[model samples]
Target: MKIQEIREIIKLIDQSTLTEFSYESEGTKIKLKKYESSSIFTNGQQLDSSSVVEQPKVAEVKAALAPVVQQQKEVVTETVEVAEESKLHKIKSPMVGTFYQSSSPSEAAYVQVGSKVTGESIVCIVEAMKLFNEIEAEIDGEIVEILVKDGQLVEYGQPLFLVREN
Candidate 1:
């Protein structure tokens, strides 16, 4: 399924009162669950409904019912420095797909470290099922780091870049 279709499902679930929702179609299964925060008050009092806050977690989307191939690859660890600025932000993936740094293989990357961007700027593309979906920064900032490499497989809500607010 396309990212747009998955987004629509998420939107519908957000508008409903259901705590859990799942959909299966054409060998793909998507499930969404809402997590409500629980807090304890002073004097050992129970928390009331007014204190509850509900947050919808990212919907998990799986490709095929049957899983087959597995490949083993080398692993490496790298340390990244995070900005001390409180306005630092992350641009997260809206769907699971293969991340591309540029529109095509031979072109320069859309954004790199120190690149300034606006909320509507297209930072990268996540290609799923042969459909390339452009991902926006969504926040005005200067790109501090690129989180994903070219052709990397990313999951829903995965951070693609670290940006410091302008």
Candidate 2:
């Protein structure tokens, strides 16, 4: 199945009550399962939700996932910084694609730190599904920071650059 089709299936399953799903077609098999939040049971006895006793396994799981959560928080913090800078305007990706700083490998980047741009200036390119789209700087500004590296995969609405308006 195509990536878009799989994404759609996941969205559909997540919105529905089904916890498990499987599909197979033309030698391609896919399975999806959602975590069920149910009462924990031990020794054939259901534990009370308000029980003071703590589960060792649950504690271990939380400890193991702490670092992953911290990493996600760091990413969110970067986005928040962009939003919090009152004088900086963010150039965000218009689509989910691979970000390119220049038109090609041999060319210099379209814009760099301290570069001046007008509203019609092309700052970068975002390639999605084989189409290369030239992204323009909608506001006249000086590039203060490039938030994404060249050739990086970027999500829609992710900030690509921070600029100070002229």
Q: Using lDDT, give the best candidate's number.
A: 2
True-structure lDDT of candidate 2 = 0.81
Give Cα distance to truth, residue 64, candidate 1, Å: 60
lDDT of 1 by residue, 22-68 (tens): 76644668899965446546588888656544533443222221121
Reference-based lDDT, residue 63, model 1: 24
Q: Which candidate is the best by TM-score?
A: 2
- Across 1-166, the per-residue lDDT of candidate 2 in tens digits comes to 5676667567656545567767664456779896645575778988655552432343453454355456567867887885668569999999999999999999999999999999999999999999999999999989999999999999999999998998
The TM-score of candidate 1 is 0.49
Where is model 2 more than 4 Å wrong at Cα?
A: 1-84
For all candidates in order, the CA lDDT equals: 0.74, 0.81
* Weakest 10 consecutive residues of candidate 1 by summed lDDT: 68-77
Tell me the TM-score of each prediction against the true structure.
Answer: 0.49, 0.50
What are the clash counts of all predictions, listed in order? Answer: 0, 0
